[model samples]
Target: MNPHNPNRHNLGTVISFEFRRTVLKPKFWLISLSVPLLIGVVVGLIALSGQTTAQRVESQDTASVTFTYTDASGLIDPTVARTAGGTPVSDAAAARAAVVAGTSQCHIDYPKDPLSQPIDVQGKDLGLFDSSRYNAVATTVFTTSIEHKIGNPTLAKLAVNPPDVQLATFADGHATAGIAGVIAPGIFLVLFYMAVLMLGNQMLNVTLEEKENRVTEMILTTMNPTTLIVGKVLALVGIGIVQGLVVGIPASIVFGLLSGSMGLPEASAGVPTLGSIPIDAGAVAIGFCLFLFSFLMFTGLLVAIGAVMPSAKEAGNTFGVVVMSMFIPLYAGSLLVSDPHGVVSQIFTFFPLTAPVSTLLRNATGGLYWWEAAIALAILAVCGWVFLMVGVRLFRTGSISYGSRVKIGRALGWTTGR
Candidate 1:
């Protein structure tokens, strides 16, 4: 706390050294670049496959098929049926018998009382989707016959296929992007987890590296543990920011180029240019706050675990458990979105570990109320601070306890030393 403290002066030095130590590694750049590159490769393959399939579909007439029809409704034009590869048959029984006997490809029976009886279509049992071909062929024949009767092709076409209806929703007497507005906060949620997942190991390594190298005692002689850990946390945050830019920028560029062709729903359709997505400023503010506190909470907890753990191998399983806990709320993601006030969602929103992700998800879906956001943010902020304090205490007690795990009771002053 002293202004003249050398440890305070050395804080900047520690941050610089830690930041340079991490970013200078070849592995860091490789892993950072690989995420976007890997995603690009997978998406490229899927797009190529889709294009190939579309080409194959266009190269062949998928609807062409042979069938027989008996139109007692006087609706079937003989010329149209023949043109569509459907032969007109007088005996409906013979038509069906021919199909059953394999003498015909399929049979369609247009009942005399078309108003009361259904049109019957029979074909060899093909798979579910493929077997609809008989109905498709018969439908084309009937529609084309109706078009001829109407005399005006355009009018008949309009009568058969009505104009599409576009539905728009308004909020506050103004047209809003509807679901697009609701999902806009999800960008913050995505960035939060992206940094957490990418930087979790780094949090553990930052503190553990000193212990592993037998340098913790020596380092503590020169710098306060609090300053050292705080510096490392700050440096890790900087690294996360850089990595986020690395991954997020390229992804944004690729998505902007591909969104139109990707058939994204209206909410996120087309390139997400400025002012295109209806983002609620309040929701985004809440989301950004939650993201920051959540990242800090996870960082503090992971760093605390590193302080207590003697080696990476000893901490691996614990690290996996903590990571899994962050995703637990996602399993009930649908419930969170559909019924944010539901019992399950409430539990996840308040629980120490699950609160960050669950609340972020609810905020993204427009389900998080302001009061709930306040409570969630307060909980995360307190937990982050508490976890950081716990990490410092654990480091003081366990940093030099090599080849053994530290007992929480002693590390946290819950029990006296022997």
Candidate 2:
């Protein structure tokens, strides 16, 4: 390899060298090995937690409902005990006692023809309390109770179910499904942001290692810096995706099986009839693409950072700030649930550094319009291109650049050929 001869950029050769860079590194292999095992342990722990939650919800259902009512209150029937849905109470004291003791689901105590008194409701002639209705049971007892006693018979029927809000939401979906959908955005955001950190640092560390060892001169003879940096970023991005798939696929499979086997209490609660984990193939695809794109965007930036810094030490100092920037998306990601379509969120969705994650979050939250998603993807693609170009420029110049501590301003100037 002649140092003076200019190396022609060949995509194939550069990629070959990049693969070698990853595979030959002992520390890279060690990290790769640990990722799967750590992921498996985390998945197992989550499954265990889910099992406990299911058991807790199921156990709570056995506790009977207790009611409080007065038999002589006239609203309650003292002569005949009514089922939980009817006006059945012997006395106010007994009703209150049953309520306190948790022996009854509900109680209806009546006055001795209490409705005859100065109506407690004041000016209301409607029977908010009726004593005669208890003799013959209605087919729908609670419905009749509300319509005849508590609500206007002519107007819209109103049944203010007080217990419903307090009761454990046994899941036939309810509002819980909507709430769960909202969580998808934040989960995708944090996951993509985390993957970026891993891939970004991996790219930075590799570039710095080569620089520190003066291997750039050796590679420069065989490959141009532009081709070299591009190939390496591409290769590392692939590895990051492979890593994501390895972790995500197994976890998804395990979660599905566990969620099915360990039937959650509210799992069958509401409308959509959820029997298993809600993960669909679409979720897997979105997660996969998000993982890949996020890693690419962050890793490209790291490669550019690596090119400008002459030594590993200089790069490490800047890495603290870089790392913070990558992870800041996670903190901001939570807002996707509350304000998925808010002004601030929309702006971040369009911005380059934040778009990959913010856009992914919007998709997960069902906030994304088709055009917005397309635009964000386009922006990310352009940014990747720009980063690759900048990385090469910085690399070609900074390969021979020597200094005490490199500065960002100096790197920017160098990237622009200053």
Candidate 3:
């Protein structure tokens, strides 16, 4: 293999090796498969329990629950209890006797003014009745009796059909969509953050592992450092994509099922569901570009940091810093959600470190102008390229220079031969 033209074969070999080491490992498969399966099992059991409970509730609802009542008020007509599907006993003792004899499940003693004076309600098992329905029935009995005594039966009829007010909400001059609009983007942000962190950590660990085990020195004999770094990063990118699909597809399906089960509206008049949010091909393309380049920029920094660190422990500290930087945008998430195009949001969108999350958030919430997205992507692409070049320089210089730790300033100086 020619030294200058050896990238093709060498790149393939490195990718293949790294892929097997990380993506194709037994643990990766176990975690990827087990998590979703466990979630599904747990959810299924909960749903089954809920269904059993609902069936029990429905059966109780259907069973006749006779109420024995003493109308001490003298205003309540015995026909009212008969009409309401209840038996009216002459006195409280008779009512209790009826309950004991299994002739009635509940007993009510009405006062002269049921609304002003507290009514006595007793039952064998109060839990057997749907509380809300039982309350409504009791209220109806009292109100109807009062209305009949007052000679205003029409008022009682009107009370049963009260007026309702419908409510709607808007944000930024646009009507807020259903819960999907909020939930879908949130889900995207979380998934994106997890994928980036997981893959970035993996890349960092691989870089540090090679350095710690002296594997880089042996591999450096056959190929250029640039080729090795590029290949490994590319392999990690592939693994990230595959891992995303492995996790994302099932999660999406489950989310869709849950959304449907919960009776979330598909789409409002002008608002979009998760499925409908992109709205056009251009937005989709730009969003993908932002995610890809943003990922490259962060992973490149992780690789560079890993190359410079002398041990896994040191790499961990650097990894924590980078992870914390990613979370900075999350702290101001409410501001971004409320005002996607505000000053602070614009700063996050333009800043390379926070651009991916900020831009994606803006895109998901309302959207940014095409020009804004283009500018952000351009900035991210440049940052990613610069980081990649810096990582290559760091990897080349620091790969063999073990024993002493590599300082960032010295590494830059060495890259310039100063």
Candidate 4:
């Protein structure tokens, strides 16, 4: 490997050119900045209206209502009803009629056999969710009356409303954040998918652009097809990183500020924290490898699709199918989590397109064994290299033909020249 190899120099030149050409475009900046700007605007509005909105909600929830109840079980204490914003009324029929006529907000009828029969609640409909307040008021009054009868307020209160629970699980004799600790490795998986989604179309266009512009011949004359294709794929990845940074940095800052303003606790008992999350060095290393090779395999696939099809429109149909294949594991996410070693999960873990996501998912869930990760990584690395080679062959054949689709047989040297 000579330091000044001509092909290496050409590859660098190609990468530099493609990256700058895409990055410097006004449309690139517009698309990249639009999401963060929209998020910022929304956050600003929420921050400004937070106090007013809280006050409005509190006022609505505590608003007085003309409520009446008929207690056939003799459990309705008049004092409790009045305190809970309800009135005890005789003649259930008259109370129901008042509610229907909008003179009263609600009417509750406690059955004679209270233990066996349901309480009948009739109310003026106040829209779907809000109408539930009627039942809430009636229940509160009945519960308070029961507490009074028990004559032990503290014990009754404890029985009625239990204290908040915080659960902690032990792993290998050490306390861990449970699900969050297990799924932490999946962050790499998420970043890989994000990069692919952002750059998949770019990968499709990179190989096809030269053909579309009818300059493939001139470009091919200066650089080998392998160098050019690899260079363009690398550039597409570079572009994805740039987009991720532009979006992730501002979003992170806004999230930090919003979390502080919202009074989120840094180490809540149930919530997972950075220090609490368990980290396995081997798993993290394998996860990063999975991310890298998976992305390369997908990029190669899209580039090959672009090289084979004559135009972007024609290529996009194939591109969509390929992208959808990657999500096959996600559709079976429940099975993956519940039974990662099952036949279906095993199929996805080994299959080329779905392997990256599947392996990563199982890795995060602590279901994928180290050996399985190795096998999946090996498959992805091989497929990625094969796809790149296939793309190079296709580019050589398809780029020479303008406005016509290149048959796979001819592209791969199975048939006569195109």
lDDT of every model, 2 decimals: 0.81, 0.57, 0.71, 0.80
* lDDT, residue 47, candidate 1: 75
lDDT of 1 by residue, 378-414 (tens): 8888888899889988998888998888898988889
Candidate 4 lDDT over 10-35, as tens digits, reads 99998999899989999988877886
In terms of TM-score, the best-performing candidate is 4
Q: Model 2, 84-194: lDDT tens per residue?
A: 333443465665555457565444433455337421111112143332222223212334454555548544143333332323333234333333333333345555655
TM-score of each: 0.81, 0.61, 0.71, 0.85
Q: Over the full model, what C-alpha lDDT does candidate 1 score relative to the true structure?
A: 0.81
Cα lDDT for residue 70, candidate 2: 46
Order candidates by TM-score, high to low.
4, 1, 3, 2
Estimate candidate 4's RMSD in Å: 3.8
The top-ranked prediction according to lDDT is 1
The alpha-carbon lDDT assigned to residue 200 of candidate 4 equals 76
Q: Which of the two candidates, 2 or 3, achieves a greater TM-score against the reference?
A: 3
